[model samples]
Target: MKKVIEKKVYNTETATLIAEYWNGLGEDDFMYCEEYLYRTRKGSYFLRGSGGPLTKYSESNENQTWGISTIIPISKEEAYEWLEANDKTEAIEEYFSNDIDEA
Candidate 1:
């Protein structure tokens, strides 16, 4: 599990991250990529993902960078489908469980 450090970049600054999947283990620094689920303050859902050479410059003589990224608006149902397909089990149980949290 190589550590993933997420930042509030130009695109996701207005939303709250709900869950993420980072495929970084054993990947070269310049080849890591990931996906994330997010929700807006108003309850809208979206997905943001990045792939390819996200860290192309980290080992080079230049500033670092994240890979190409994309944001897609999705329905709540779609969000759940995506999460399940990606095996985000913890996130599903935590965020969409029928049993309510007492907190």
Candidate 2:
């Protein structure tokens, strides 16, 4: 028989914040971070296969796997706070700096 691995990868505080943002999901709501790698940012996480904002699917044509999505706590001082709180990972080079770009 194959072993069923547990899917909770987050530390207590991060997990608690995520739970608050996306409440009502059950234990099996979705896969965990360790199931696949993820990039955690100030207000959201970008999964491997994300196709930017315009496309729902990932940009890679050869890839078959759909990208994952995650919720993040929203606040005005989010980016600064996030860097201070978490490990100092690589700096994000590109991001939408304007609200109009989202549409």
Candidates in order, TM-scores: namely: 0.58, 0.20
**Tens digits of per-residue lDDT for model 1, 1-103:** 1122343232467677888878764345566767789877777677776666544212323665445666767788888887889888787887678633546
C-alpha lDDT values of all predictions: 0.67, 0.29
**What is the alpha-carbon lDDT for the whole of candidate 2?**
0.29
Candidate 2, residues 40-99, lDDT tens digits: the string is 333433222222222343223464433333322233345433433443233311322342
The candidate scoring highest on lDDT is 1
Candidate 1 CA-lDDT value: 0.67
Q: Which candidate achieves the best TM-score against the true structure?
A: 1
Give the poorly placed runs of model 1, Cα more than 4 Å off.
1-11, 25-32, 53-67, 98-103
State the displacement of the C-alpha of residue 61, model 1, in Å, after optimal TM-score superposition. 28
